[model samples]
Target: DTAVSQTPKYLVTQMGNDKSIKCEQNLGHDTMYWYKQDSKKFLKIMFSYNNKELIINETVPNRFSPKSPDKAHLNLHINSLELGDSAVYFCASSPGGAGYNEQFFGPGTRLTVL
Candidate 1:
């Protein structure tokens, strides 16, 4: 069984469009997170949630919104997508939380803005 999964593995859109990425985890972990992997292969944390409360919000643009409906789901909604938004978005789950526990990442969602 897939421990962590994301929808629409590939996303292609034009600039100024809006998009969303859905993430789900079956690991029964206490915390879940969202990260953006740049072309340089650098992973940057975008958001983190524990017990349905947002714990981390990075210095990303306000167009990016992270929503957690529950402990098992983390969905990212982007408004007015820009070219800079093109990257691989990953969802991860940390057993205890995003603090120091190992994070299991879901297959990334590739976003391309034209």
Candidate 2:
């Protein structure tokens, strides 16, 4: 019944590791986004998809990729995670690709890289 959902709410891994976070939305939204909130609580957009096309991609580590096979899903894959990669990864979705649209976020998946 959730609008958006992510698996493995907490991820704890060592440095130089790899991880994947799965995200799914049942709201039938066409635009989905992956956001990272650092320790300072400042959220930044990592990637966004609209109709399976990457609409917005912000500056982030090349090891981080947001893969979306469909409109209702966006899965994050991190390779060789570093300590700087530790943050709360959030999955969000909106009706449109515009950033101004009201976004629905799922319970974040906290990634802690030691």
Candidate 3:
């Protein structure tokens, strides 16, 4: 069984289109996160949810949104997708909020915008 899973492992679309990626975890974790890995291989956290409450990272743009209906799932929605938004998005989960546990990442969703 997969500990963490993301649907539609690859996404290809044109600029200005909107897209969404779904993620689910069966680890019984309390905290989940959305991270983006850029072309330069820089990984950055976009959003985090603890028990369904959201905490957005300060540097992330408003075009990115993360919603969690429950503790085991976190879904990412991107509006007005831009060229810069093309990257590998990863879903992760931890037992508790920041600094308490190691995050287990999903297979990742690669988004390509033309």
Candidate 4:
């Protein structure tokens, strides 16, 4: 009964490979998001979806794509992964509203490139 969960706490792969990360939420939230934290620990928003519709897209590489199976799940797929892609990917969710709704983040999936 976790509010938010992500599979494979760590991922390691060679450059040019492709991989994916799964995310799910049980809190009945309407908005879901993906964030990447670099080695500097700067968390940056990548994409956001509300009610299965994309609402925010921060400047990100095209190799990264986010898919929402439903309001409760959002998956991230990365193609042609590069060394630069090696970072901690986090899934988050929040209630869709006008105010400053706090986002609940997953433990995070650390991706390592070789």
Please identify which of the two predictions, 1 or 3, would achieve the higher lDDT against the true structure. Answer: 1
- Number of the predicted model whose lDDT against the real structure is largest: 1
Which stretches in model 3 have alpha-carbon errors above 4 Å?
A: none
Model 3: per-residue Cα lDDT over 81-101, one tens digit each: 999899999999999977869
Note the clash tally of each candidate. 0, 0, 0, 0
Clashing pairs for model 2 are none
| Candidate 2 TM-score over all chains jointly | 0.96
1-50 in candidate 2: lDDT tens per residue? Answer: 99999988999999999999999999999999999999999999899899
Poorly placed runs, candidate 1 (over 4 Å)? none
Where model 4 places Cα greater than 4 Å from the true spot, the runs are none
Worst 10-residue lDDT window for candidate 2 reads 92-101
Query: 59-110, model 4: which lDDT tens digit per residue?
Result: 8989999999899999999999999998999999998742689888898999
Please provide TM-scores, in order, for all candidate models, with all chains considered together: 0.97, 0.96, 0.96, 0.96
Name the lDDT of candidate 2.
0.92
Candidate 2 regions with alpha-carbon error over 4 angstroms:
none
